[model samples]
Target chain A: AQSVTQPDIHITVSEGASLELRCNYSYGATPYLFWYVQSPGQGLQLLLKYFSGDTLVQGIKGFEAEFKRSQSSFNLRKPSVHWSDAAEYFCAVAANSGYALNFGKGTSLLVTP
Target chain B: DVKVTQSSRYLVKRTREKVFLECVQDMDHENMFWYRQDPGLGLRLIYFSYDVKMKEKGDIPEGYSVSREKKERFSLILESASTNQTSMYLCASRRQGTTNEKLFFGSGTQLSVL
Candidate 1:
């Protein structure tokens, strides 16, 4: 079974500040990694996903995540964040042939001006 | 754009009452899923359907059932609604035959069981 772990339950970053949200997964073999964001009163939206090949994957809203196979980590990072980037982020992991995704507890991002 | 439409945005039901949550997808997706979201829990899968009349129990399937008589529509049923079942229900769909699994989600239906 693949599981995702997000160490930070809540994170606060100032506007124009660099942001990094850490994510770790537990799987014996290579797993599929994904990052999703959910705004207030909105549904979950896909940010980026890493299946294979490139270790660094780019997503919408200037977000990117790097997949480190050796460390079993897929951390999301942004050079600069905006106030509108305040939302809850989730990290999910699924097996290569799995049908369901196991999501983390989520990290609530608060962007302070 | 892929669209997954859940019938209700919000619903209030009484304990022991029978409840149904409907979901439909516009894109002819082969897989559809039902999930419940809580404060700490990001999302817990309840049920999923791979094809019409084919269903699979997800991580948390107790106290809930699902019906998929058609390919585009998947229905979640709670035989006896309970307060613990009160949460945001989300429906998602994704095309099969690929490992991408980029799910298209509905707006979600907030069900409050009293």
Candidate 2:
């Protein structure tokens, strides 16, 4: 079974500051990686995903993630974050070509004005 | 745009009561999934259906069952609601035969079993 580990449970940053949420996965082989965001009282939305090709993947809302095979990580990064970006972020993986996705516990992001 | 709609936004059920969670997709997706989200637990897949009348158990299917009698609708049933089942239930749908496709999710139903 593949599992995603998000070391940070919660993170706070000032608006316009750079942000990075760490994510690590445990899988024997390359797996489908994804980053999802959930706003208050809303469903989870896809931010980005990485399957193959370039190691660096760009996503919506000025966010990006790099799939580092050596480090077993797919860390999401944003050079500057907006107050609207304050939400719960999750890292998910679909292993063994399965449709079922395994998600991390999630990291709650807080942005200060 | 694809839209997944769950029947309820919030539900309150008593213990030992039978519960049904309905999900419908506007798009003719071939796959639908049921998941439960708990604080500090993210989301756990309960069941998924690939086609009408085809259902598969996901990671946490021990306490839940699913029905897919129609292509665009999938239903999750809790035989006996328990306090432990209190959580946000989410429904998602995806196009079949595509690995790169993302799942379209509903707003989710916050179910509370008392």
Candidate 3:
């Protein structure tokens, strides 16, 4: 079974500061990776996805993630974060053939002024 | 934009009551999923339907059943509601035949079983 691990349970950053959320996966082969964000009382929204091609993928809301095969990691990063960026972030992994996604426990991002 | 609409934004039910949560998709997607979200637990899949009349069990299926009589609608049922079942329920849909497609989600229904 493919699984995703997000080490940080909570992260806080000041407005305009750079942000990075760590994600690691355990899969036998190269897996499909995704980053999702959820605001309070809202459903999950896709931040970005990585299937094939370049390791780095850009997503909506000025967010990006890099798939590092050697580290079994697909970490989400942003050059600068705004207050709206404060939300719960999840990392998910799926097998090449499976349709279901395995999600992490999530990391709560807090932005301060 | 794809929209997956869940019938209710909030629901309250008593123990042993029958509960049904309805989900409908507007994009004519072939795949629909039901998941439950709790604090510190992320989202756990409860059930998924790949096609009309075709359903699959996800990570957690206990005390839950689903119906997919029509392609655009999928319903989740709780035969006997329990306090443990209280959580935020989310419905999502995505097109089949693609490995990289992202899921479109509903705003979610927060269910409280007392």
- Which stretches of candidate 1 lie above 4 Å from their native place? none
- Candidate 1: C-alpha lDDT: 0.92
Candidate 3 stretches with Cα past 4 Å from truth are: none
* Winner of 1 and 3 under lDDT: 3
For candidate 1 chain B, which ten residues in a row score worst on lDDT?
Answer: B94-103
Candidates in order, TM-scores: namely 0.97, 0.97, 0.97
- Candidate 3 scores a chain A TM-score of 0.97
Clashes of 3: 0
A1-113, model 1: which lDDT tens digit per residue? Answer: 78999999999999999999999999988898999999999889999999889899999999999999899999999999999999999998878753777789899999999
For every model in order, the fraction of real contacts preserved is 0.49, 0.57, 0.60
For model 3 chain A, the run of ten residues with the poorest summed lDDT: A94-103
Clashes of 1: 0
Top lDDT prediction, candidate number: 3
Residue B70, model 2, lDDT:
89
Could you tell me which residue pairs clash in candidate 2? none
- Lowest lDDT 10-mer window, candidate 3 chain B? B94-103
Q: Mind giving the per-residue lDDT tens digits that candidate 2 earns over A27-60?
A: 9899999999999877789999998899999999
For residues B6-73, what per-residue lDDT tens digits would candidate 2 score against the true structure?
99999999999999999999899888899899999999889998889999998899778888998989
RMSD (Cα, Å) for all candidates, in order, is: 1.0, 1.1, 1.1
Individual DockQ of the candidates?
A: 0.64, 0.67, 0.69
- Interface RMSD for each of the candidates: 1.6, 1.5, 1.4
